[model samples]
Target: MTEHAATGPVTRSMAVPLGAFAAGAVVAVLLGVFGRVHDPTLSGTTDLGFRTVIEMKVVVSTVIGVLVVLQLVGGLWLYGVLGRRVPSWLGTAHRISGAVALLLTVFVGYSCLWALGLEVGTLHNGEKVPVRAVVHGVLGCAVFGAVVVKLVAVRSRRAPGWFLPVAGGMLFTLLMVVVLTSAAWYVATDGWPSRAGY
Candidate 1:
């Protein structure tokens, strides 16, 4: 009876986000599998004119990092963490930043996943890649999944008040991991303007 009491109330509020997140998780899992299964030797480059796809990705990811920082601060402000009164312009700015960041993230992911997928061992793209590349791939996939969860949580009327904040924070954390692994690592090892000619 106690177990039933705990689990039986699977209300619409709970079910919608749960189901939405599960679907998003599936998308992430499929992306990870694609990264591993795809031919790493196959090469493609972005027309954006960076000498390599990785450079383009690093540039995009860097922008995304800045955008997420904005999102975090704005989120805190909106939640009254920074102040009692929220700015009228802040909510719109937050939404815009989030949307742009998500789009840029997708662009980077698509470019990387298509051109290189996941690299293993030494000398994949004329450069040595470490295990972190694989880890980055996994985290990259999770970001998209988290994005879906956040989007659903945002739109769900029945979701608890705390649910959206928790979801947004989690998504931001996941994205930072992706940025650190790919963008920060690339800049540190290769320099700010990547030798690949960003």
Candidate 2:
């Protein structure tokens, strides 16, 4: 038997990915913990010269969600896991899409935290808050953690081959949750800033 055949399945150390995941989770928790809830009226007025922050978030988040879907497709193509031949430029495209997704996510996340803070109940209108809002808030924090773990797994030589795909999937799922709960809900409920609940 060859030397390769003699050894069992290889396994890489998980320290780097684990540590990175922990760090990311901590950062996310800190933001939620320390975030100060403010009046939506004051925060809602923050605009990018032409549009309010809420409008910008809705548009940006929708674009990011689309890009994330592309990232999934590109990743699968690059790995040849979907039965498609790996294009020469697929890896580059995957990387680019992932970077753009990350950047957009970061922007939206910052805007959400800064403008809305970590909120759950419907204190503004006395309406019962939907479970989707609470889940979205929780998953928003998880998105940051997932992103950090994915970044570390992608960069670490000691990370196992399966680590990257799993991390990427987790990140994608979290983003979808955030997008669906916030942007999709906003679109379905209210088109723009006609009221103060989104």
Candidate 3:
């Protein structure tokens, strides 16, 4: 009689997650360190007014946040995590959404890092910085890092079956954190573009 062999060691299964986590952490640390060293003034100028660019970023981020949600839903559907049969076309939709999301993220990240640097708070002659701003910057870096991890997990042939789902979840959560701290905060404080006080 023939017997079936079990899967390999638990450590082998964990390799992808551990590697992705390490890579993401490295990316976050690098971005934070870069922001600390770089001067905001040295950033590239946009043809649009400063406030206009900021407002544009907010809009883009909101749209990206929506896309992230859709991506998450698509992922869930594809994995049968919702206990529903995934349509064949759903895979294509998910890929398209993921591509668009990544593109949007790249644009926003460039604009943020180039135009604003890591703006924690306004430094007075003697005053305490706002904790929110600091948290926002940290989360922004983490968003990028999570994206990197997701991309790596998706493309890696050796990655475990669970890697993509976990990476996608992390990416979605980080994106939401970034949106809440930056775009949502902006909308709350400034309202929409036309009515924004700048």
Candidate 4:
């Protein structure tokens, strides 16, 4: 009976969610570990016209945070958490916004990884990165991991109905934390750059 217990319907049904959790954990750990070990590029040029790469990352992170809020609302609407009748257009909009938010986050993540690695005690603008930035780096990696869970759960027919909503909420929460720790904190403390009114 104990042997079959592992193969019970509830357990079988939970495999996808379990797989998702493993995938997220692996991705986050790999990225964070790699960042800590890699030799950062340390220099680059951007024609996108931001006053600094830091500013660019901050702005994009903020935008990603805003889009995450929309995602939470859309997910609720689609799941009938908000009410019964979801608009047909909501799904498409949700997909588009989610894609954009993901791309933006990837851009920021790539920039951070390539230019600065995990920061830790690394000097930036003549000072070591604060603890919040280190927290942001780790959490930022976790956001992409959660995104992996959400994406797989969203696409997998075998995934339990609750998986999608839970994955989405997790992603939303991680992103909000990542944004708060980095972009929002920067804004609250330092404000915008003199030339980066954007």
Candidate 5:
């Protein structure tokens, strides 16, 4: 029984969640790049517009990169630790990684809201920027909300370990939505640079 448990169902059961995490990470990286499409080019040009805009872009990119790396490390560690059974050290690393990832995500969401140009006051083309900005903002907030729920569950010793994974999945979906909708918006407007105010 011990050998079977070690080699069979235990190992196989871990695969599903691990695969989900891998897929989510891939989606996050791709979507993160799209989220920062308007950011300064690699050379870091800042003279073309308000400093706030460029600063916000840099903040968003930095936060996204940090969160992405944290997530990848956490996901990989989680798969290994959960699969082989948690060790003392990896468990601590997992907790630390999770906390850092959540913190970065919260900031990333703030940056994302502005990056989408949906801040409290902003006029774009005589009308507020597209509602898609709101959608992206709300979704980003939801991801942060999920992390809060998961943290509460952890401290309280909750039964199900569903909140974190659910949060991850929601974040992934939101990223995709933001990417596609923003692309569509850009296309419809004939590009931001070509507009009169731009």
Candidate 6:
């Protein structure tokens, strides 16, 4: 009975986000596999340049980009000021939400590395170079570390109060910094000024 009670809420809380994420994963896999079989490499550069590739990159990037922004910003606010005072359910939700965000953060980092050659030693000369890859990489690492720290805090209930909150703030700052830098890099390299060959 006690075991059932404990497991029940955990399952309930995780259901919605886990379900949506799973469905999205299935769709992405289907598209990637089916789309690649016919096209092999999808779109690449042309004399007209990489309009399709760039647009596809931006659409997915922008969606996950906004989500990362929201999680970092909102997570910080929740953990820093209100964490001490919030009811237990809210705190549990905060941790659950953060776990999901960390998963997204890792996925985005790896996807960018594959899709845009953002990882070190991955870029071919002609690929679009993200000016902020190093910064984003560092933040991605930090996000991973913070997730560990958060988990430790949850497990060790006597963990220092400051550990979790500081981690939250760090995540918030790192994400925003990466997003702004990436945006700047995109504009600088791909904007009309460069496109016009000026």
Q: Write the per-residue lDDT of candidate 5 for residues 90-109, one digit (tens) a residue.
A: 65776676566556455545
Compute each candidate's TM-score over C-alphas: 0.83, 0.81, 0.82, 0.85, 0.44, 0.47
Clashes of 6: 0
- Top of the candidates by TM-score: 4
Per-candidate local distance difference test: 0.83, 0.78, 0.80, 0.85, 0.48, 0.49
TM value for model 4: 0.85
Tens digits of per-residue lDDT, candidate 1, 33-93, equal: 8987887642454636666677778888999999999999999999888976897998999
Clashing pairs in 1: none
Clashing pairs in 2: none
Give residue 62's error in model 5 in angstroms: 4.2
lDDT score of residue 141 within candidate 6: 44
Global CA lDDT computed for model 2: 0.78
Better of 1 and 5 by lDDT: 1
Worst 10 residues of 5 by lDDT: 39-48
Q: What TM-score does structure 1 among the candidates reach?
A: 0.83
**Candidate 1 lDDT score relative to the true structure:** 0.83
The residue-by-residue lDDT of candidate 4 on 1-198, one tens digit each, is 685587665433788999999999999999999889988884663425677788778888889999999998998898788987998899999999999999988888888887778878857578877889888888888987998999899878778878988898899998999899988988998996445455
Q: Write down the lDDT that model 3 would get.
A: 0.80
Model 4: which ten-residue window has the lowest total lDDT?
42-51
Top lDDT prediction, candidate number: 4
Model 6 scores a C-alpha lDDT of 0.49
Residues 71-174, candidate 3, lDDT per residue (tens digit)? 98898888788898889899999999889988988888877777667766565365655787788788888888898899888877677887888888888988
Model 1 off-target regions past 4 Å? 1-12, 40-47, 120-129, 194-198
Best-to-worst order by TM-score is 4, 1, 3, 2, 6, 5
The ten-residue window of minimal lDDT in model 6 covers: 39-48
